[model samples]
Target: MSIKEQVRQLWKTCFDDDDAFIDLYFRLRYTDKINKVIEEDGKVISALQMIPYPMTFCGQTVATSYISGACTHPDYRARGAMRRLLQETHRAMFAEGVMFATLIPAEEWLKGYYARSGYATCFHYGLVKKVINSYEQPVDNSVSCLNMSKIDLLKTPQERIYPYFYEQMNRRPCCVQHTPDDFHVVLSDLALSKGDVWIVDKNGVMSGLVFCLMDGNTLSVKEILLSDEADFAEVLRQLAASYRAERLECIVPRADEMHELGMARLIDVASCLKVFSAVYRGEGLYIRVTGDEAIPQNNGYYTVLPGKVSRDMQEGQTYVTFTISELTAFILHDLHPYMSLMLN
Candidate 1:
C-alpha cells in the first residue's frame, strides 16, 4: 500500500471508527497538513498528522501545529516508532519556527503517551451530559422574536463564514485564531465529514452557530458560537431535534466546572513568551527553563520584561524558574480558558 493507504488502514484499525467518517476526516480536516511517519522495511509502521492553525494567546497569534490521528500498527507496537516519530516532528516544528504543538487525546489513556514527549494540559474542558430520556424536543421555529435557522454550511457565503468565525472566536477567550482562508479550508473539511453546522442569525446576520458530530443517536456539540446565554439553550434544543440526537454531550459547559480538553507543548519558549510578553506586566524577571533535548536553546536563563526578553540576566529583578513543561502550563493558566472543541 502507498502512504495514504497505509495510514488509512492503520487509522481505522487503531481507532475503530466508521471507515467513511475517518476517510473524510483525514481528507478534509487534515488538508495541507504535514504528515510524519516511521517506516520499517519500506512499510509505514506509525504515523502522525500535524495540522497547522494559528492560536491566539493574550491577544497575539502564535503559529501552532495540532497533532492528531496518531496511529501505530499493532504489530509494530512496543517498538519505539511513536517516540521517534514524535521527536522528529517536534524538531521539525521548532525549526520551522512554530511556537506550539498541541493535541486532543481520543482516549484518557493516551494522555500519558504524549506527556513523555513534553506536552502539558494547557486547555481545560467541561462536559455536561443529557440523558436520552432527558432530552426535550425543540419548539416551533417562529416562537421566538429572534429569527434562528439551520442551513448547510456549504450554503453559508465566504464573506459571512469567515467574519462569523472571527466574531465567535473573539467572543470566547483563548481561542485558536482563523483567517478567512482557514475557514474556507475548515468548512470544506466539515462538508466532507458530513458534519452538521447550525446557525442562529439575528434578522439576516449570522449571530450564533454550533458544530455537531453525529453518531448513531448521540450528538457531540464540538463547538458552540453564541452571543448570549439564551442563544445557547435555543441552539441546543433545535440541534437535538433536527439531528434526532438521543443523548447530548456539550464540551463548553459553565466556566467553573471546565475540565482539561487538550495537551500543549512549547516548541519555542522565547518566541511563545514574546506573544505573552505583550500582556505580562511585571518588573524585569529572571528565569530559566530546562528544555527538551531536541531544542537546545529552550533550556536557559533569561531576562524578561513586559516588552523585552534577553538571554543575559538582569541586575535586580523578580526571579522565578520553571521547567519548560511547567512554564507552558503556567503562562497559559492566567486566561482560565477551557479547551476549545473546534481545535479537536
Candidate 2:
C-alpha cells in the first residue's frame, strides 16, 4: 500500500473516528508534503501531518504548524517511535521557517507526554451553554441569517465569504488564522456533520458568523465571532429557533471564563523573542532556556532589550532560567491566544 493508505490503516487501528469523518479528513486535509511517518520494514508504524497555519502574534502574522492526526500503531506503542518522529518533524519545521508548533492532546494524560517534546499549554477557550426556552426565541426583524454548506460554496462562491472570515479571525491579537483552503476544509467537515455556517446580517452588513453542528437536540457552536453591535443572547435565540435545538453550546474566546484547549512550542526562539520584544518594548529581561532536548538550538542565554533580542554571552550575570515549556508559556501568558475552526 502507498504511504497514505498505510497511514489510513494505522489511523483506523488507533482512532475510533467513523469512516465518513476519516474519508473527509484524508480527502480534504491530508497531503504528502505534510505527512511525516516512521516506517519499520516498509510498513508505516507512526505518522502525523504538520499542517501549516498563520497565526497573529505580537502585532504581526507568523507561520505556525498544527500537528494533526498524530498516531502510532498499537504494536509500536512505548517504543519511542513517536518521539523520533516528532523530533524529526521539529527540525523540518525549523528549516521551513515555522515559528511555532501547536497541537491539542487527544487525552488528558497526553498533555504530560507532549510536554517532554517542549510543548506548553498556552491556548485556551471560553464556553457558553444555554438551554433554549420557548420564550427565548425572538423575532428580530432587523437581523437576517444566511445559511450555507459545502455545496453552497459552488453557488455563493467562497471568495465573498472569505474576506469577512479572514477579517474577523485576524482581529484577535493572538489566534490561529485559517487560510482560504483551510476554511474550505472546515466547511467540508461541517457539511459532513450536517451542520451549517450561519452568517448573521444586520442592516445589510455581515455582523457575525457561527459555525455549528447538531447532535440530537443539542447544537454545538464550534466557533462564534461577533462584533460589539451584535447581541449574543439574540444570536443564540435565533440559532435555537433555526435548528430547533433544545440546548446550545458555544465556544467563545477567552473572556470571563476559560478552559484549556491546546498547547504550543516555540520552534525559533530568537524570531519569537524579536516579535515579543517589538510588541512589549518597555519590558526587558535576561533569561536562560535549558530543557529543549529535542531542539538544542533553543537552549541558551538571551537578553531581551527594548525592541530587540540578543544572546547574552556574559558568563557571570545573574539571570532567570526556564525550560522550553516555561518559556513558551511566559511568552504567551498575557496574549490569551486562541484557536478555532481547527476541527479539534
User: In candidate 1, how many clashes are counted?
Assistant: 2
Q: What's model 2's TM-score?
A: 0.93
Q: Which lDDT tens digits does candidate 2 get at residues 192-240?
A: 7777777777667777888888888998998887767778877877778
Per-residue lDDT tens digits for candidate 1, residues 68-166, read 788898998988889888889989999898988888888898788778778878777677677565455555678764555655777768785567768
Please give the lDDT score for candidate 1: 0.74
Stretches > 4 Å off in candidate 2: 135-155
Q: TM per model? A: 0.84, 0.93
On lDDT, the candidate that comes out on top is 2
Worst 10-residue lDDT window for candidate 2 reads 145-154
Best by TM-score: 2
